[model samples]
Target: MTYFVKYLPVTTGNSTRLYTDGRDYCADLYEDLRSAKKFVFLTGLHFMAEFGLIRTGKPSDAVATLAQVLRQTGERGVQVFLLVNQFWRDESEVITGGHPIRAKIMKAGELYGYLPETLKLFDSLKGLKNVHCRTDIHPNSDIFATHHQKTVVIDDRVAFLGGIDLTYLDGDRWDTSEHTARHRHVDRTQKFWHDVHLRLQGPAVEFVRDNFLQRWNHGSLHTIRKKSLNSYEAWSQHIGEDPRHVAVEATQDRRPPALPPFAQKSVLSYTYPADGEEPAAPTVQIVRSMPRKDNWHRQKPTWNTNRSDEWEHSCKEAYLIGIRSANKYIYLENQWVADEDIWAELAAAARRNKNNPDFRIILMVPYEGLFAAGLGSNQELFIGTEMEDVIKASRSPATFGMYALHQHDRRSNVQGQIYIHSKVLIIDDAWSLIGSANAGGISLEGVRSGRDEPDTELSAIIHDKAFASAFRSKVWSEHLGVPVGPTYDVHDADRFRGLANKPGGKLRFFPGYDNIKRGVPTWFPESLQESRDPLRIDFAKQSRIIPSLSRDLLASGLPPTLVRAAFTARVVPSVPPGWRCWYRWHCQLHYDPTEPSGRDPRRAPVYLKLRSLKYDRDEVWNYSDQDSVYIGKLSAERINAETTTAVLGVIRCRVKILPLDEGPNDPGPSMVLQFECMFLNDRFARGNHPDFVRR
Candidate 1:
């Protein structure tokens, strides 16, 4: 049985603007923030204080930064409300050690930075009489779960929502497909990032505004300072500050030039798309995974409660409905996907049309984890393998294919893989859902036991084909580096293949190495609407764990799966050799009618998991032998009259073989290699011919 429930739809007229990544999204959001004349309301997982939207390094310094603009707007008597999620996690545990109880106390004192890097931007705003900031933790919410809604509703007329978090992962996030790593400084914590965001207007945005106030009016602020920042006692009194009652009151001293309390907010009003930009005709609905328990109760509730709200899980329901109703195909981009119900639902959709043989599910996720689930991130690999196996074994009519996106400079060959961090879904190019919630258990589940409850999340549901079609084209254009105009039909399969087969594509697609025999249109990714993948993708040459310690495979009594103990010697001083990874990448693919799987010389990931060799014990580092290594047609030979494939073992790795043996106590010179594989979409098509498949 699948998770399905009818959700009462909150429908309204709306206008929307789609953004590819933080580059344009943040810039546009900055414009909206600076332009708002009345009030600014924002909620997010992380409102990073470290100047995210302001490009201080670039030439543009004309406009004020977001902080300065926010301050200036608030100073003009405009009400500003910021609700940030401040859940607990010993975030600084790596850097700062502490005693348990005392550490908790000290962490509370340093409240602004204690959360998961979410709410520092508004810390300085507490002083402003007009700008109100509060960090929220639901009385029933698991301490490990925080509010993960990324939204902004300005003047009650415009809204911004989606997967783009306001943080500086680095300048790499700001570049186009033709990326240059000139600003690449990996050590400084600025790694290139990629994400998607959206802008909204009309009645639909009204719900976005109301969501902020509902939480704001019910929300309680916890301030650390002793003195009140405002001259009048209204601000403190409103926050339930009883000066005479409790001597240990949580009071805050007023900020610079301390003005009297600002006027209160009443009836909210604003014009749609303020500048009179034409509003899109999309019918939109505001969907959310908001808790039913509003800030209604007066007293601060205890840590965790089980008071379920009216809105059980509207966001999750929305996803199930979309997947179940998808007729032609389902295109998705997400950060994490650990939902078994949704996977089953998609498989069911495939099974429904098995006789006719045509249902498509194109999913794009990070080739590796975005930091949460690494290549070796526990059960993800296991579950992923299971999902793939289920789709193949069932022989369902649905064609499920997944691919990772990458971009490389032609000259320097500095390949930058575009991380699919957007939590997005477009069903049959008719409906779209975008927001902060992941497809994983943490963000999708309504409730969970222990410390693994779902984070507070928000998403917008757009049912307009016009809006969804435009959004899909925008994504495809950015990826393929070719202009797919607004009128490109979403239902056209041959057109997508024709465009895909044509020469130039800025972005490169890498189907999972195991998908070689699936014989689907691997070249044309999910964004491009294509027909069912012909080949069912069946292959089995799997071996990801092989790093036997030379000293003794089991001499130290460590299990066979581990490649541990590089340096552990109390008396004799004997250091074990590090892991050496070896795996094959099947390239120059051709139809081998003679082979049982219809494919020979398969490519599989060479996985190596090593722990505490020189690093910390708690963390496991993942490395692939074929990472950044480019494998092409080294030379293909015909095996039979009807089949040909790349000669096995011809694509040898140039990277130094592991097992650094430079004496007993020395970690030898570090070896580095970059790899890239030419992913084949069709085995028998003219595109896979030697003349078309280039270096």
Candidate 2:
């Protein structure tokens, strides 16, 4: 018989062998490792070196704890295996931007040499006699694709999984007490992040154990084998070479039932046919897509393409089934909300009143783009463009409102708008999904244009009501700014009644819905619409000319005052002949080549010239490679020097350019380009595009 185990706090009937906040969770993990004797397997998105625990002065408590556990386990002669995402290799950098508090931590770490030391710790563990730690990177995409599953198994008897990444922030909670308020960073007044984690025993432990082992074996530098006591000549003299050997303490006689490595284990010892098993063990499948094939985890054997249907079946499909299965409400919190299909489904569900008409669908997303204020160009432009399209397409004209959450600082009046870093889904208080995958084609379909095929993403479909209810409640509480309590019923009749009577209803517009409905502008100043005729001159030329003027102004002087003035001026440039023609033909182009170009030439290059007309535009807009306006595409063969010189001279003599708009709302010098593309009949038809009409 196969058994299913679900661990969630406040869920009915679910086991609670492990329960703790972030601090206790880490402490307990350390305790579990210290007591383990046989084997240890660990995997996480990040495992930083010793650093003080958040809100506490215990220096590098998490790291120190893990190191102690490793040392103790090694002393007992246990074989320990660890796998962490290679993305963590660069400890000095922040994974996502927008948080000044985190930025300060990163800066301090750099100053204190924390990054190098962290790398050294991993190196030391890898060099240990009995410990093996490996880092893996996925091939599907760069930082965008990561091995985000967090799991740990000790002696193949205990395991954990959830949204918790191995980091200090995940473990810290607000003190709530006034005594700790004086500590600038340790204020207990604010709530710590809210999340869920599960601990499992029985056969499920083996599944997690195997996952870590597979990742370790696949990514480790050294080869390892399961040492059977009977096969070891030295151990044979001691225990007659039994497959199960005592590395330190004697083996316990209380063995639960033994099954093949791949076989599922349950309370009752029942063997199914090698090729067949009924009601597949309530197994939580582990899936990951990495950049490097040799990172750490052993890759599963490729499915035989001979059976195409079977191969397709084995591949994880997008969460269409989960979305469709939602009965009461759909609660979502994700890093980004740009997937059109997902938004469509939500709208359909809301309109159909699939659950009670009062049914609620709440989405928690970062108020601003994560990449808005960082090293990379503002990715928000592209994401915002997509978001706008989705919202526009899904708006019920009935009743539906999307709200955003942001973090705020009461002291300085600075709000750190809530950045929806968590990827979670709760459906009708029945199912919950927590994983690394985002809401995009690369995550959902797995297929990226230039790649061979879409790979697998890991996610667990939890059916435990306790887990779902708890998750939904916490998510809703945070989104609605309510205390964590069971005050609202997701399926309450009054809720549905209230939603249906609204202007559009719960599926229709709320007061502030317009703000969420509109996508981030492709161009700044709202008044300056996108122009396909690059030469089209406008009075507010601020958006069109400021980006160029800002660049020139920056190069002109290094003085802080001058730089400030230049940025504030919002001075842009008049469209050059070529730029004007390109924009007219393509709709959008980057004004600066050095700036981040949201468009991939392979995917969209038509708006390359728009780069020259930069403003507070979204980053995603770009021209396609097939666009006729692209200068690179036009010049298949380079023109001779004589032809270039003649063309340059004629253009220089014909047009005299000047700066455009300079105003307060000019959005400063660091302008981004945003583009919009219209597709008709399954194909991108440029002539009929709405953006072109404005030009």
Candidate 3:
């Protein structure tokens, strides 16, 4: 299998360096596009026309940056195409419950008025004839599975890619000074956010350009010229190749790097575009994936069979190639760090001889979970537990370490806390991939997100020694807790010495008891088994009395509907499936090495019984308790005494109730009673139970 890679060069000695703040980058990009003579193709997840250039101010009066770009290029007879994720306006209506009935009616009227206004904006770009703008929607999933890849390719000679979007949010800056709420809300406060982006000029530009063309032409909606076509002009001129573009000599073709215990591929050389009108750069390959069909607007579907496999292959190949070839160290930054397989490989590499220690891997991730809020009950806990498992599985406890950097406030002398937004990997000193692809299956396989196409992403390989050396140095400085300056060197002993000298600066190990300077503690000083087990709880006893208590509340003049809804929703303190599994596993694994008896057999059944009960209960309690409450509240105030009695009778028939079962010896009954009481109390508090409220 052929793996694609490219080299990007950073312009040295220029303060015009790229920074993470979106506004600065956007301004620079806009200038670049305005000056372009050749082809211009741009793609991003979302691009609302409302937000414009500039930070902390009314959007620049540049009413038609995009439209102007099209017209100018068209007037120049240049081929200009723009591709955006086909966001279904109606889908939002369905997801958000039709966006408030009032808003829907108002929006319909506005659309009628806005259509003519939008047409006027379209007419302003009359000079540019060869322009086409369209939206590409993926079929596999909803609007959330968007074409997130952001790139701007001009004449296949220069390209830009990173988390920077074309929308308004992309232009905000970090602000450290305290400002009044009104001032901050009015966009006067200099609130900056951390982010990263790359400009590619070498062979990589071709890959990005190709990706944009493919997405634009394959989109569901195709824009046509309002008038007859005049002469067409090419967008860009082929300036000669940059002198720095080196020829890659073929080495003995090694087996494509494999998941470790197998040899890995090393980075040989990288090609990047040189800054300036200095000749064009070497060839860079660009690879992208998205849903096969454009579901953004209603259109015919485009199918690609190998897209999933190809997307997964890209990330795996990149890692394998980089890891095998890495001789010194690897640096990575991502929004999340939870990939078990890759962590395993790093652990293996770290376990090698202490002298060589394979390669040092450094990762920077966000301080808090990105999608933790959306996860159902216990999902966040499961993810956290799994991440720890990955860390422990590593060969050496110290093999991996994570950190977050806060951008400093120049005025307050207080550094803004670091928020990692860039997903980057730099292996050895030779290979680097910077793009929007997170370390997850959805980004890799395009499967879970209902995406028919792979994630729209862009990354370029960098080969320049100076660029790699500088970039790697910056990352290392952050990892080693060194100030960013010329004093640090990865190969120098002083670098390690400086780290050792800092207060509480000793190297920390994974799964081992140690104190860290920043971030939460991962390992405990003593065995974790001795501490209380949060998962341990009885389900059977809880199940028994819960139904009885719920029925009692209903019989006592509580709305039956409310009681039923609360019971079905299961929100009133009950063992969720994951909690049960965890509890069981903890008991089974909670072995005391000090005990003379080998692993306890009694502890083994704990997990088994838990699993069985969960499976069975799932059948009994699958309905929504919330729904029940909603319905019961609307019913007659008088309690349906007969129905309540029937509910209690059914509970008694289904569950074996015993007084002793309420104690520690029988955890199930106790849990059932606790759930039952809480359910009734909640109903009474809500005035859903007339008897309790009246009494």
Score every model by TM-score: 0.60, 0.54, 0.51
TM-score of 3: 0.51
Off by over 4 Å in 2: 1-24, 51-55, 58-65, 87-118, 124-127, 141-144, 168-196, 219-298, 301-318, 354-356, 372-399, 409-415, 441-447, 450-457, 484-695
Scored by Cα lDDT, where does model 1 land? 0.47
Ranking of models by lDDT:
1, 3, 2
Best candidate according to TM-score? 1
- Model 3 C-alpha lDDT per residue in residues 1-695, reported as the tens digit of each score: 11232232222221113344455566666677777776677776555443344334455545435555456556776666666554332222322222222122223212211222223334555545466545454553241244668778776567788766654232222221221122111231122334567776654454565455444544444232222222331111111232111111111212211111212213233333333322222223343444444332222112212323323235444554455455566566775444444555555545442355433556555432232111111111112323344345443434445444433344544332344556677665555666766554334445332223556565554433445556666655544555555332344323432343132332222111112222333322233235333234333411211111222334546443323322221211233322221111100121122332212223322110111122322222221111111113321222232121111101111221223213222343222222111112233223322112222
Off by over 4 Å in 1: 1-6, 50-63, 89-94, 97-120, 123-127, 138-143, 169-190, 219-221, 224-281, 291-311, 355-358, 372-379, 393-398, 409-415, 450-452, 485-695
Provide the RMSD of all predictions against the true structure, rounded to 1 decimal: 17.9, 16.1, 19.9
Question: Per model, how many backbone clashes are there?
Answer: 18, 71, 63
Error of 1 at 317 (Å): 1.0
Q: Which lDDT tens digits does candidate 2 get at residues 1-695? A: 11111111111222323222244456556777777877777776556543222334455444454555576577677777666554233322232222222333333222122223334446555545677655555454222344656777777667766555554332222122111222223231232343445666654354455555444445322221222434443433333333212221112122222222444334233222122222222223333333324322234422111222211111122244456565566667665454456666765666556335545666554433333211111223233333333344443322234444433345544322333455567666655566555554334433333322232344444545566666655544434434454434633312322332122111211112322344321122223335434345442322321101122322434211110111111112334323321111223321222322111223323222222123423221232111111122112112221121101100000112222433222322222222221111111111211111111
lDDT of each model, Cα atoms only? 0.47, 0.37, 0.39
Between the candidate structures 1 and 2, which one is better when assessed by TM-score? 1
Q: Model 1 over residues 1-695: C-alpha lDDT tens digits?
A: 22122233334556688877765776787787777788888887555554446454675643444566677678777777776665432223211322221222223223323342333455556568888766666544322345778889888778998876664422234443444454332222223455777898876676666566555555433433233335343342332442221111232222312212333332223222222222245556666665545433422122112245433356777688778777676777787765666777767767664553445666667644432221112222223333554365334313655545555445555554556778888876677888887776557653333222356677877777887788777776665556777654443322333343232443322233233225434342342234222121111111121111222322444321211212111110111224343222222232334542323334343232223333333122223333222211111112222333221111222222335433322332222222211222223212222211210
